[model samples]
Target: MDVVAWQFLLLVNPNDEDAALQQFAAFRAALEEAGGDADPAALLRDVIDWKAGFHVGEDDAAGLMDALDELASRWRQRIDWGLDDDADAVPDTDAVLQTAFVQLRERHYSLWTAETGEATLSGWITHERDEEAMQLVAGALGLSARPGIG
Candidate 1:
């Protein structure tokens, strides 16, 4: 499926057109890399950090926190992980992530997780204003994703 530039723009660059355009170029190149038939799921990793996104092992709570913190810092914000960012202090990776997701929502940022079929969680963050349209964006790119919590 060929996703339009505008749609890609919305998904990666909801607030900055210039940045979105830059990413769109990279996204297009990524699509072209597979002879114009690349799997969107696979292409996600390449495009993730172009703006902000993460893919980490399920049990790597510290890594997740670090990735999230880096993304948040890009926006001049921080996540209230509800505790110190020590992996041991965190009871469950799920709970720590759930809390971060909630905190992100309150800041107009949406954190989404996708099923990876592995012992890992992968997803991206978008502005809250774009939250409602994220699933559609995912569909257009042929990705199955949802907001998950535990």
Candidate 2:
């Protein structure tokens, strides 16, 4: 996709409707000089929401499992610390994460909540996902099932 100077300016400052044409030209010039074939998608790979959480830091299976175990433990604690008077009412959190497993897929799956938003996939998931996996992730993340992102 060829990005024009005006398009570059719009991306840089969407609110600045009054951005000068000369400034945009200069910006595009610099961008072209730096590299015209720069992949925008690759540059913004980390902009996804599912990439949140503690990095495995290592590329080995043991390291990935350790991270997943730690994440599961922390989430379980938040779901039910066992100190509540009605602890029985709080169902086992393990059932929700039963399907959680480390797999070498095109993308890494993740689940987290607003309060305990400290979980992440050990590796980066940078490809498309099926509907079933998306639903599983949504449920695990405690996201609303109200259809769209309204």
Candidate 3:
């Protein structure tokens, strides 16, 4: 529905573990208490059944992006595989370094669209992350970071 602001969360477990059910239960309870008009609890129920890492928030884009950027940076560092130690190890800067940034940017936009009701929240809440939709969101946000990537 039309949410004034949104908080998007991405939770991950390297092993693809299953802790989302409990967390979602608690989150739904909180949403109920907050009087989520669109019945976010129901929306979340549909979302968490498949996408364990996805979570919503209440009108907090800046905070969300900051968190995403931090998460992206950490993910990039981990995935870079020690390339940071030496220039020689750098792997196709344009192709490799931008992957995480792109992913993060996409996530930011997807959440925004869903939150703003520009796109249907249930439609956006899919089992998989929609990279294309994310790209659109990032573009709108003018998301930029180091080396002209967002």
Per-residue accuracy of model 1 over 40-63 as CA lDDT, tens digit each: 666655576535677788998878
Per-residue lDDT over 1-150 for candidate 2, one digit per residue giving the tens place of the 0 to 100 score: 224323432332334445425444444455566596653322221222122222432223334434445544433312223236654442223322222322212123333212222232222221123334434543443432211111
TM-score of 3: 0.29
Identify the superior model by lDDT, candidate 1 or candidate 2: 1
Q: What is the TM-score of each candidate against the true structure?
A: 0.79, 0.22, 0.29
> How well is each residue in 57-114 modelled by candidate 3, as lDDT tens digits?
3333333333334434433422223334445543342333244344444544222222
lDDT of 3 at 4: 12
Better of 1 and 2 by TM-score: 1
Candidates ranked by lDDT: 1, 3, 2
Clashing pairs in 1: none
Give candidate 3 regions above 4 Å deviation: 1-19, 31-38, 41-65, 73-113, 117-150
What's model 1's lDDT at 110?
A: 77
Which number leads on lDDT? 1
Ranking by TM-score: 1, 3, 2
